[model samples]
Target: MSEKMQLVIDGDSVAFKQSAGFEFRLNLSEFPDLVKAHLAKVKPTANTKSTQACESLGAEVLEKDFEWEFLKPFIRDVCRWGGFALIYAKVLNEK
Candidate 1:
């Protein structure tokens, strides 16, 4: 029998087949570092928009919503792979 891992997000469940084609196991609970690293990218951009605009015109704008901004790039990158996790995360409650 193939070993399967189940991931439930927003009441919907997805079964990841670990033995059929892939040999890896994904432990969502074990990704604290990954989560932290992703959140860290948003920290610098936490400043208010008015404060950011006061800087030079050529200066980069630190996105107000870090989580949302980060996902934009990620969604574009994963467009070829089909968007499952992005939708899943959008519906899931992190808090």
Candidate 2:
């Protein structure tokens, strides 16, 4: 699907354009800082152990990049629609 979304940043605008080739592009060279600020507003929540809520929200946020703000939402959307799971597993250390 080909779609275009416009985002206003720093009194300027960025055109987010996607094509059928699975290519996504952001055109806002004039205000990268604005983009960064916008992205920072969507930070991930702290790790949790609950199952139900964790699974739901995790699935929503997992497919996104940890640092790249402009690309995280789209990635997360694709992952969720694709039925991908997000896990937060960690090992413990013995003293």
RMSD list, candidates in order:
13.8, 13.4
Q: Give the TM-score of candidate 1.
A: 0.23
* lDDT by residue for model 2 (1-95), tens: 53664433433334443444344344456366765774566444342222334355555455553444633443444344333424111111110
Model 2 spans > 4 angstroms off: 1-27, 47-95
Clashing pairs in 1: none
lDDT of 2 at 41: 60
Using all chains and alpha carbons, the TM-scores for the candidates as numbered come to 0.23, 0.22
Query: Candidate 1: where is the Cα deviation over 4 Å?
Result: 1-15, 18-20, 42-95
lDDT of each: 0.41, 0.42
Q: Compose the digit string of candidate 1's lDDT tens values, residues 21-68.
A: 653444566567766775555332332222223332113224444366
Q: What is the model-wide C-alpha lDDT for candidate 1?
A: 0.41
